[model samples]
Target: MSRASARNVLLVEDDTAIATVIIAALEDEGFKIEHCTSVAARDGWLRGHAFDVMLTDVMLEDGDGLASLDSVRKAAPDMPVIVLSAQNTLDTAVRASDSDAFEYFPKPFDLDELVQAVQQACGGSGSSANLPDEPDDDGMPLVGRSQAMQSVYRMITRVLRNDLTVLVTGESGTGKELVAEAIHQLGSRRSGPFVAVNTAAIPADLIESELFGHEKGAFTGAVAQAIGKFEQANGGTLFLDEIGDMPAEAQTRLLRALQSGRIRRVGGRQEIAVDVRIVAATNRDLVPMISAGTFREDLYYRLNVVPIELPPLRDRREDIDVLCQHFLSQAVEEGLPRRQLSADALEKLRGRNWRGNVRELRNVVYRLALMARDDVIDPGSLADIIGDEQLPIGQSGDVRTSGIGQALETWLAAENPSAGSVYSQAIAAFEKPLIEHALGRTSGNQLRAAKLLGINRNTLRKRIGELGIEPDRFARPL
Candidate 1:
């Protein structure tokens, strides 16, 4: 290929020898390569030049490869990033893909296969600005295939035909943003920009500026005119994630904008009319918020015109195997040797209560892909990566002193329970030992214990109280 036509490749590898070899190979294949050893350097290079593809190592000296992948996707949505890792664990591969990696390859990969991946990525075989950085090999929908998810898909199809206000409610990590993307992709507004803003992530003081454009000198840091998400998403979908976290003042302003279909710049009186569809998502119960007077009832009703609730992963265990296989295929496409979960591993995955939902499962799978020694992952390997304390009851019974059967018996022995009491008891029994083990691992520091348990400190404390457990006994001596 001519120099003008050559694909630009950003090679991010710490190992100089490996980088040299890959650069030479890629050059031989008529591609231009720019090599960097860290995310910081890569970021600097990207600001000055654009690349068709990026090849990154997971454990960079300065930062993580996944973070770099996210940055690249955000800056250049169409560019493809392929992750390289020496660890080669299932989690690494799955995470790389889930983070929008175009592909993942273990260290010491075949040169020909790597070149092929680069070629396909650069050739735009599966390229789109809105397409996931990492494509799902199984072509499954972003969420589960449960009746709930099927209903979500059908609603999304219908909503895409018009610009309707969408309210998606679910627990965190239930893929609410994914649902928003689906609607945008299938809707008449496909050609318009899809802007997403998390109300919780932004500081309460600056939220109004984030949603409505600000004129230069509007605030201390307003050095230049800034267009907000609303203006950017005009004629498209503006996904307001964590809408429940929005402040009262911002909520009132947002409601007015929704009703009038217009927004005024923070420092200017000019009213800019926008034709945008608002899609808001939240994990909180808005009905309760409305009743409690924290959230406006009128705003809640406006946003909830088309309500969609995403079922948590626990409710759709039937789709576990399918999700696992889908992630595996994606891992293989990333360049790892193809892998599969053993029957025991699959059972372990299916039985777990994924509190973090699909996001957590994807992380577990990525870790397993990197750590498993064989093509078929086993329960032991899965437990090791997810940690013994976090493994499901059926998978790591040994980690808990109280056996699953014993815990179940004890829970069933409790009296005067409500309907689904058995299910509640079973869950507590399964979680109690794990929490105890995690506390043991962390020497009963509730904060660390919560991290080990993959939950918030407050939630962990609540569970400890509910289970009638004490931490002093398991705590290590200071």
Candidate 2:
């Protein structure tokens, strides 16, 4: 690029280390660099000079970077702004796009990519209509800075402007309802009431009346007219939780209402029009249910118009530290004394696999805040609390006995054995199921079962002999 036509780049960043690296790269590209450390300084510079492209950070010494970008948007609508943020949440990315910034870059960002964005931004273009950022006071309730959560945030933002039905799928305790509430709170119908009905919680006989309302004296117990969830959620969003558990009869009624955009009371004839956005969530796999003819395929199609899959906490270990801090802050606000987690304790938390996802983590944090004596939670304190908590397993087994420790404890509590033999008995009790499960999973192929068990085939064979496990029962017959 020639000096005469070289672009002017304004960088608003506070960290000197990051600024130095950015300035060196941009200056070497022949662009004139003007640095501003705070939003106040940036405003003054904006008043004095015209820049070809602007790069700003989310956090500055004086004010929030994303919030301040609105000024640049108004002052020089045509000058493209590239937002760099260390706050790599979905909210940050959405706010950047809403501000009409040319592009958004998460920190530890690739410099080569930033350069490309600046180069593209330098190409002159007129201002576009502005999208107002979400209110500062209304922070993102769902917390996670991982890339997985970022994808979820982007999806939430996309569907916020529309009334499209959304289906949120994740394991239990992954905050499915929270996602539903976020969409309702942030979407165009923020003022409307959000009514959530759990399909599984309601009895099968009452689901119809629970959702579609009923006329007075409609049934044996119907003394008065009842307004159902669909009508209650009028002009807003209706969240149907555990939708897979909705009985077949209720599923039919729901599908009909979704298709026609109208509903009739359980025992009344007049069709009532309901302008409700449906957001359904389920932990069960609807596809398999559809195949089994239990869950309605049509209803699945209707609610799945916009699908949001929330990742479980175990998959996003990067977020564990932040989540723990958030829960700890919450506990403090709710009357617990302020407490902090030691670095070692946080690392230990990050290393463990959370079966209950965010909910489980929150519970542990709350427990620690209330029970732990130390102001700073250390590994020892964390271990004592965590060790007492039972590790949950998959749906295939009973949770109480599924965990090795829990199973051993249950056995010892029941049997009065010689203290010496109790240890061996417990070991055998734990190993039996584990080896059986491995054999079952591998169809009794010793080599495959050994691999699954992470042990040598010979060791596995020896263990089978010692434990008296009948591997032949599980073996695939010739």
Maximum-TM-score candidate: 2
Tell me how many clashing residue pairs each candidate has: 16, 0
Which 10-residue span in candidate 1 carries the lowest summed lDDT? 126-135
lDDT by residue for model 2 (1-478), tens: 3322478999999999999999988887778899989999998889889999989998999989887776876777688888888888867876776676677777777798788777777865633555444655355678888878877876886777678999999987799999998888776687899999988778899999999999998999999999999999999999999898899989999999999999999889899999999999988789999999999888999999999999999889999988998999899999988999999999888877665579878977886786566899898777554452333233445544334434355446655666667578556445665787788778889999999989999999988866546586677653
Candidate 1 structure, TM-score to reference: 0.56
Give the number of the best model, judged by lDDT.
2
Residue-wise C-alpha lDDT for candidate 1, range 1-478, written one tens digit per residue = 3223587999988999999989988898889999989999988888889889988898888988776565776677778887777754333444553565666676667788788888889877433233334333343347444545545654664464467899999886688998888777655676789999988778888999999979999999999999999999998889999898899999999999999999998998899999998999988888888989999999999999899898888887877887888777777777756778999989988887676678767766765675466888787766654544444443445534323443444446668657888797566435765787687678889999898777899999988866645575567764
Per-model CA lDDT versus the true structure: 0.76, 0.81
State the TM-score for model 2. 0.68
| Model 1 spans > 4 angstroms off | 1-143, 335-337, 388-478
